[model samples]
Target: MSNEFKDILYEVGENAVRITINRPEVFNAFRLQTVEELIVAFQRANEEKSVNTVVLAGAGDKAFCTGGDQKAHLSEDGLYGPRGTVGLPIEELQTAIRDLRKVSIAQVQGFAIGGGNVFATLCDLTIASEKAVFGQVGPKVGSADPGWGTALLARHVGEKKAREIWFRCKKYSAQEACDMGLVNKVVPHDKLAEEVEEWAADINQMSPSAISICKRSFNADSENIRGISFMGVQSVKHYYMSEESKEGVRAFNEKRKPDFKKYV
Candidate 1:
């Protein structure tokens, strides 16, 4: 029922598979190994016949995930690793979740910022705790999601609001996120797990084949965003090498505000 891995925990339950980001010490931020492990876990759930739902969560109550580990990325020469474009296999991970047949749910109990916000958005359903906070920090961090993180997000919360989330980099409460259509439900912090289970259980009762078909049909609409992501990622690769980007990382590491304008 449980599979072991560093950075993350994978477990199979009644008809659902749970993948939890386990590095709460850094607020569950992921590094290269973490994303790689996550992809593998998602693939496992995809191939499992009995699994009807996949739950993505973060360990501890502080954060679901805060996006990529800036500290790790900094140590790796400004890249997450030598795996994918932009130094992380982000596109593949996003594809793995989007292309997954079974319903995927984001069980958010705390902060879901940066790429974590993207994860919550991409999930078929997002159930949040009352204490949850959602937002994007790509631009603020001298990085950006470009593709699914932007285009797909616009589809969820609308262009104006999506721009506010990315450009402003401000946080929103669970109710605010729900009202904006980023989250499906928001419950008390302690009841988050129970609420997610009930939602998963309800989903489990549906016909799997039907669900899969509907999921694909829905995806077909915005599939073009994948191309946008490809182009954007290529641009980001170059951006990462710029002083502007490095400044962001430097400021974060130094616990100071980034003087990005000076680099411009």
Candidate 2:
């Protein structure tokens, strides 16, 4: 929430709170530090009583986010930040977006892959640019988002599609995402901000109290998203502590296929 944010951008507009993952060089993948910044940024938006909606985005017109920072994940602690036992504050960010009462929207441009896809999935709505790509890469990267990225995704796009998404790790185009119910709408890359702002404005015109009730109503039946946050992080944490887990991170950094068979 502080102006000193290095990994992301946070701005409070009259009607909306906009947060952008600012690391374009790595296709906007999140490090543990980046996830920590997101948690604080979402907290900033949640506390803004006047804000009617929150916009989640990525910088440089490429990749809204690509999930955990593989480079940083190479360390001993793997993908954990300073907070939480496992160090991934993703569950907190997801909770902040859901519990904020206001509409949480993902304004995705491109490469919303891995856990980044969960950033879009768990949102109340997703508006994407024509260039946007959505997918899961956890298995390929020696990771997985067993939280909302799995159960909630199944609810959105069905069990079979969700399985294919995670198991196959194939990226989907914006229109494909729309047809699969991953996004609400898609526009030209140049018009993404305009479209998202307009949607936020319209949502702002609605009664905040009413929206709050509606959001809670929608989530009241499903609490597992919050409950399972630790499972994914913990599983990854366990793998990270093992010598076998080194291959994926090493192969990723080296830009080659991970020889998991060697580990087996």
Candidate 3:
């Protein structure tokens, strides 16, 4: 295992590579450097011949990740920048998650909120702790866009549930997420690592080439429609940057609920 200052650790063992988010102080909140490191880790895992499967987990007991670093996102001028242009560079993180060829699993332990939830859903499979809580809190934080979260959430839980999650910023438990098909499995906190390792062992026993091909096939089918939908949704980001979104941000920063009633 290799340790780093940023919120990432890379380890290779027993035909599997494990990447852990290492910032427990802030609930493993993402910084821009963390995204870059994760990209590097994913590339390394993809290129390594000895690694047949990849696992993602967060360090500590509290949270997998709470999402973007709000303090990091606040500029010296005190303004929130556009989604990918600020904080953790979510687009790059999403691209890295999307590029993993080996079977990937997210072993989520606790809070998986906002961009954190997006990160977990990007994996091929998710094994969550029974105590974990997941949600998209961007809306509450004054962000109009959910980044790549919309794509994966809609695919996993369908459009209505996805809309409810993002629009309402409601938190759901691991069991609720599992019942809604957002997670593959939920195990006790103590069993998360063991269960993930067992699953990875089974995956590692498969023919690497065959597993890679199967992953690609399923990934393409799963993402094709959502990709097109994302393109369309992304085109409207400029609208999110307009006065309405600015007002949303301002209202949030001021600790008052937005007055969108007039727009309604």
* Clashes found in each candidate (C-alpha, N, C closer than 3 A): 0, 1, 0
**Please, what are the lDDT tens digits per residue for candidate 2 over residues 1-264?**
446899998988877999989999999988877878888888878778877899999989789898878877766655455665556666677777778778999999888998789889989999999999999887776777777889889888888999999999999999999998889999999999999999999998998899989999999877766677667667767777655676777888899998888667
- Pitting candidate 1 against candidate 3, the one with the higher TM-score is 1
What tens digits encode model 3's per-residue C-alpha lDDT throughout 51-105? 6789888889999988766656545333344345443345566666777779889
Per-residue accuracy of model 1 over 189-256 as CA lDDT, tens digit each: 99999998888888889999999999999999999998999899999988887889988888888899
- How do all the candidates rank in terms of TM-score, highest first? 1, 2, 3
Quote the RMSD, in angstroms, for model 3: 3.2
Q: What is every candidate's alpha-carbon RMSD to the true fold?
A: 1.1, 1.8, 3.2
TM-score, each model? 0.98, 0.94, 0.85
Given candidate 2, what's the lDDT at residue 56? 90
Pick by lDDT: 1 or 3, better one: 1
Higher-scoring candidate on TM-score, 1 or 2: 1
Residue 132 accuracy (lDDT) in model 1: 98
- The candidate scoring highest on lDDT is 1
User: For candidate 2, what is the lDDT?
Assistant: 0.84
- Runs in model 1 deviating more than 4 A are 75-77
